[model samples]
Target: MWKADIIESPPGTSYRSVMEEYGYEVGKVIGNGSYGTVYEAYFTKQKVMVAVKIISKKKASDEYLNKFLPREIQVMKVLRHKYLINFYQAIETTTRVYIILELAQGGDILEWIQRYGACSEAQAGKWFSQLTLGIAYLHSKGIVHRDLKLENLLLDKRENVKISDFGFAKMVPSNHSLRSNSPYRQVNCFTHLSQTYCGSFAYACPEILLGLPYNPFLSDTWSMGVILYTLMVAHLPFDDTNLKKLLRETQREVTFPSSITIPQECKNLILHMLRQATKRATILDVVKDPWVIKFQSEQPTHEIRLLEAMCQIPFSATSNRHQSLDYHI
Candidate 1:
């Protein structure tokens, strides 16, 4: 049994020393955020390279420390999918919270687009299909990844898509269900709506931009539309420089570039996702789209079965734990 080790390092001890005690040799920093830095490390027990996000308790806000941080950990603990970054473990200390995760060596999708400039339609289709599968799995579990953008989509060594960053993710209220009996039909599953206007401005939906209570799942699909659009053009569909313009642009039709030739099927899918929130395409709808079906390798049934099996495994059985602490920044 992997026990989650939530311990406090002794006075004067460094994070590297604490990680070393847990069989991880911390290496160079790979990524950075407002309150944390992600380090590339080697886990001796597993003999594999991993990414460790070290968040400083002192720098994080009270809301983050008391609410979002715990929720992020809780959500990551249960998520298991090929297209999602695998959560290894979390070790919290007095000063820092260390989250060990699967390392996506190929870097984020944004970097790839920056380097290669827009992907070919076939390549974008593959990545989009993989992303849809991952999102479907999350929606099936009733979890909404409120943040979905090109920067959050990472790639492994094989260039396979791996969805990362769960800081803004939230589980739907217990009363509302997100699952549907048919994979092709859009079910009115969410009676309750999310008011939290979270995620990048360019990827945010019109409902969120207008401060309306929006369906979280549908908002996620809106971000997917942005991602797919970005994947094809190597740039965001809408410019987010001004709030009013952004709102106007989202409400209106999304214009495509004449420089690149995009297939009608692909354009149609993007339009469906970027349409009105009430009439937007759900994740299931994306999965069933002709372009997605052309690249999707696993059937929707396989994803459902995988999610069901993962749900059966208790969190305690998979992670180690020490004493819990109440923290406020």
Candidate 2:
């Protein structure tokens, strides 16, 4: 609910000044990853909750700024879709860069699954539509989210999904080849073709696994399909403690148990998504699936309205405290 426009960043001010201006009190560490650590913060000026990602300056190597950090910021800046996380303003100083962002109190989809087991088809379908809509919007903007997994998908208190973390994101120019050894360049014309394997190996598609230049957007669809399957079964389709065995299982087509009776529409969608590149479903094809139609018809009456409230209303200007209730406690 932070008012983005009024969030000030002044020249020569330190990181502490930036947080203090917005009345942000640093709290317990909520999460941490390679890029930085995130802290739960209370914005006193706005009387609202927010997540402040405090990026350690020491971690800001040349490779990180050129390839990872810039791309992450660019992707988030351009993506204004409903199912995507909202980025407030970034405050940079000699020692840190504090990224103020919307806080999803309900945590991520992974936690939900672990706590409640697999979701019913009706539940999975409801969430899937919102997810794909965001993905489609990203594709339209020519940005590819290389990593798409349950852990990266957060659900607000209202059960609305928000896609987060763009560390591995890529923005392909209009004329850039989807499959090529082109160098990734940022400011100052630095460039390098990626040789190291990237993204979560379990969710990675065949092209990435084979070390070929793959279309990140297309690979995401396959990962989404896997997530959909996990939501239905309460577990991953393929599982092996050994890394080699796990990769081999993922390389082959996913298989379900005999007793599980997934809906035909859901089955069709999964099959289309799991197909090899030459036969997989296109973005358009996914939107046209029958399961998607049925899924839309079944959304809880409250979900859409709550999400609209979150998107359109900023907590800073409002006198009401109920806005926070839109997220789960």
Q: Which candidate number maximizes TM-score?
A: 1
- Per-model root-mean-square deviation over C-alphas: 9.4, 13.2
The clash tally of candidate 2 reads 3
Query: In candidate 2, where is summed lDDT lowest over 10 consecutive residues?
Result: 184-193
Instruction: Write out the backbone clash pairs for model 2.
Output: 1-315, 157-327, 157-328
Backbone clash pairs for candidate 1 read 2-319, 2-320, 3-319, 3-320, 3-321, 4-319, 4-320, 4-321
Worst 10 residues of 1 by lDDT: 320-329
Write down the TM-score of every candidate: 0.87, 0.77
Candidate 1 local Cα displacement, residue 93, angstroms: 1.1
lDDT of each: 0.82, 0.67
| Per-candidate count of clashing residue pairs (backbone under 3 Å) | 8, 3
Residue-wise C-alpha lDDT for candidate 1, range 303-325, written one tens digit per residue: 45533432333445322210111
